[model samples]
Target: MINLYEVQETNKMIEESNLDVRTITMGISLLDCCDTDVDKVCENIYNKITTQAKNLVSTGCEIENEFGIPIVNKRISVTPISLVGGSCCKTTDDYVKIAKALDRAALEVGVNFLGGYSALVSKGMTDSDRLLIESIPKALASTERVCSSVNVGSTKTGIDMDAVKLLGEKILETAELTKDADSLGCAKLVVFCNAPDDNPFMAGAFHGVTEGDAVINVGVSGPGVVKRALEKVRGEDFGTLCETIKKTAFKVTRVGQLVAQEASKRLNVPFGIIDLSLAPTPAVGDSVAEILEEIGLESVGAPGTTAALALLNDQVKKGGVMASSYVGGLSGAFIPVSEDQGMIDAVEANALTLEKLEAMTCVCSVGLDMIAIPGDTKATTISGIIADEMAIGMINQKTTAVRLIPVIGKDVGEMVEFGGLLGYAPVMPVNRFGCDAFVNRGGRIPAPIHSFKN
Candidate 1:
């Protein structure tokens, strides 16, 4: 199991190819923290999360130093707050208090972000779910480290158009509340369809009701490594290109597996899955868009982009599954404009448009992500966009999400800096044609016919 050559290769990837563990997320279930009283629920949630994740950040640093691998973020995910506050949170303010409790716990444990300020209402919204969702704008506006998500559609339960319509309004409210920070609160909120139970990514990760009390899930990324490998086979045939990507992905996943195992053993938490997503960053070389360009496209949004992305996504999953038995989450390439320099370049060059990006989401890892629009865009337009993406995920039976920021006081071509790993983005224009009538007719869109397997 110990080989010098493999070790040297890994080191080279780390030092040159931008290989790094994206995040090591600890999923902590907060179901046991629920109580009949609001105060008790807050106390229980704070105590549980702090106790469970006390050593998370330190352990991550320890692993990084020992292995000489970069661990970018240490995060925690708790069970959806809607469920945890069902019995006790009778008002929106009650739910906001729970969010404050979660934020305090995150700070006490030294994690950068804490997820699971979430509500799952794929088919229908319960009273508690509605309350938590309604409180998101204030909750995010008030907290520093808390992130929120709402699952409004799934293959089995169809899309909850009611929730979709409500989220459109809430998202705008969130933007206005955080307008001073360039509407940063909207960046921390996500709307999902067919959301997975164990995604380690931010703005979307939550400890699903099905998971255990505690587990360690690691997300590994290497878009730069994949692009560099592709460069070696420039002009090679499709088969050669595919093989190169597969072999490279296998190697990368192995590194994540090692880290996940080590983190689990050290933290005494059971190992979850390894998410081998080609999650790009603002760094020059670490871009999924560049990898597509290397695949013979003149630019990322040009013809054959979807085919190129689909091929890459499929091969990555194939290779990742071979490296580890439990490969889960959004295990494919992510295309976020702010996070990836190449995508931002494409947007500035006028080669990538909102329509093109939406088409690409059909094949990429997640849906339209980290995109900023004008401050004056209508709430109905946002709801329409969310409905379209949700329909895609429900029909395809794959995880899809939207993290759009309607930057307050910003318009087309204006840049909003989110800073750090979130990078920056130009405010892209959305279609002005109204969808008021379509969005106003609210009810569940029935599950696809293919969902009748039972």
Candidate 2:
């Protein structure tokens, strides 16, 4: 039932490649933590996170040591604060207070990031959603660890053009607000289509209504490992390549499940999901682009790259689903430009463009991530990007997102460094021909025919 040589080869790849788990995120639902009083609500939120997630870091570290595999980030995602505080918070300041509390809780628990300061305005925005989006800049600027997101579209609901327009303006405002902080606020915010509540990834993760009140969702990443596997099988047939990737993904996802179970047991939180996304880092050897290269592309964005990625993504899900009973979130291979060194290199070499990247997202995980564009790019163009990605997700019925940064004072081919995990990206050019009329239509793109199934 197994190939020892193949397993040994994959192990060698894991050792040589800079592969590691990207994050072990504990999803703590705060619905039960809600209250009519603002102070009481904040207290409940704080208590729930602190109590349920107290041992998250330690457990993650123990798993790392026990398995000899690095776990890069220990984090938490809670129910969208806007929804939890809807009945209690009357104004923007009330939401800000809750965000500050989340920041403090994250600091106290020793986690790097805490997500779910978010709202789902895909169909329409409520008063609470408006206040939450309005306060994102202030909340992000004031708090160090808190992250935010807004879901502007989904498969069944179609694109919320109004929400997309507002988020476009919010992106510019957020970038401007944190320009002095290297646009760090924008780094912490992600605008998503078909956003998942159980996602364990940063800047966009949140505990959705369907998830348990308190649970652990682990995100396993190892693009380097996958690349190395592909390298050893160079010149091999496509069937062999697919099998190799599937076997490797089984190993990676198994590690994730083990760590998630241990962390959940130690923290007294229910285990949620294993997101088997091959999330990359800025470091060498750990790159989704490298996997593409190993899969026969001279560089990412080359011809046939999409087909290779589609096979890779499908194989990963197949292996992960078999490895664990519970698998959710945006699980596949992430191709964030700045976050992956290979992707950054590809962009610099003129091998990749925004359009190509968008095309790739149709087959990959997490659409149009960490992309930097000229500051002068119109709001409508940015909205156009979101619209395009959302359309893909709606049509395909999968999770996709756009986290493009309109770096202020930055131009095409220029670089804006966010430093550290956020990494750096060259400002890619946008379409000169405006999408004004398309965006100005300002109405929902009706859900696809497929979504009408009873």
Candidate 3:
């Protein structure tokens, strides 16, 4: 284990490759903060979060300087607001008050984003869940750092088409509400099927009810490092390619483990899982698609792309599991269109389509992420797409999500700039064919047969 060569290689990865910790998310439970008075609920959670996460950003900076590794974002994840506002919160406006409080707390703590402006309606929508979903547009438009998610489907429970239909309308409204900012509000909204409890990455991270009071989750990133490793083994056999990726993921995850342990100890919080996801950014060479291209594909969306992604996703998991005892969340390859330079290029070149991306999500970690669509796209059609992706996750028993941003007043072939990290993307067109009838008939699609194995 004491090898100078391995240590030197790790250093090179940090120096040369765009290797870094994507986020150090502190999950804080807001259950105990719940109160019948909406204002009291807001005050309680805000005070709790501000007091608990006061040192989060500063600590992350200290760690980055000490270890000489970059920590891109420091975030907070609280309990799903639906649970906290269950009997206490009355109307959509009441929930919006809570959202503003979350935004204040995030700014106070100096964190980039604060997740858990969320509801879990996989089985059915409760009164609070309905109120929260209805208020998404206003809540998101009014806040700066708050992120929201709605779980409309899960493996144990069939897809909630009612929630899907409603969320489709909400998403379109959110875009319209933030049209001046390229519909940025929709960018912070995610619809998930079987959404994880401990995911550190957002637009979808919520500290589930089962989670403890507080904890630390680290999401690791190193797609550039994997792509670089593949360069040395160019034209190699499949075995060699897989092995190379495995070793690269191992090294990347090992660093995440170190960072997670340090953050947990410094904060006096329990160490949560290390999410070894190959999360790419807008930066060049730091792309999951580039790693696919290096695997002999001319372009990322070319034929056989799905097979290539399947291999890469599997190998990353294999290499990561051994490096960290607790590897959870969506610990696989991410293919966000706007966030990955290669993916954005492919979309612009007309090489990638909405249909192809949906097909690819079957094997990748997330579904239809950061794909900007024409503003005129019908709400029913968006719901239909969510229904399809939800079915995929429900049937396969995998965590799948949809974060389609329909830029208001924009059409296909137009570009919408969401600025840093979120990057920008050309609005891709969707099939206008009528899925109106299917999505309009709202009810739960029964859980798959395998889910009946009790």
- Against the reference, the lDDT scores of all candidates come to 0.95, 0.86, 0.94
- Which is better, 1 or 3, measured by lDDT? 1
TM-score of each: 0.99, 0.95, 0.99
lDDT of prediction 2: 0.86
lDDT of 3 by residue, 1-454 (tens): 6388977887899889999999999999999998889889989988999999999999999999998889999999999999999877788999999999999999999998999999999989988899999999999999999999999999999999999999999999999999999999999999999999999999899998888999999999999999999999999999999999999899999999999999999999999899999999999889998999999888888999999999999999999999999999899999999999999999999889989998999998989999999998899989999999999999999999999999988999999999989999999999989899899887899988899877
Q: How accurate is candidate 1 locally (lDDT)?
A: 0.95
What would the per-residue lDDT of candidate 2 be over residues 1-454, giving only the tens digit for each residue?
Answer: 5477755754565578766778989888899987899999888888888898888898889988876777889999988888998999898899999999999899999999999999998888899998898888788888999999999888888888987887878888888887776566888889888898789999999989888777888898878888877887999999999999998899888778877888878877788889999898898888888888888899988998889889989999988789999998999999999999999999999999888988888988889899888877788888888899999988888889888788888788888888888899888988988887888887677888888878
Q: Model 1: per-residue lDDT, tens digit, 1-454?
A: 9599999999999999999999999999999998899999999999998899999999999999999999999999999999999999889999999999999999999988999999999999999999999999999999999999999999999999999999999999999999999999999999999888899999899999999999999999999999999999999999999999999999999999999999999999999999999999999899999999999998889989889999999999888999998899889999999999999998999989999999999987899999999999999999999999999999998888999999999999999999889999999989999999999999999999999987
Return the lDDT, model 3, position 382: 90
**Backbone clash count, each prediction separately:** 0, 0, 0
Number of the top lDDT candidate: 1
**Alpha-carbon runs more than 4 Å astray in model 3:** 1-3
Find the 10 residues in a row with the least total lDDT in model 3.
1-10
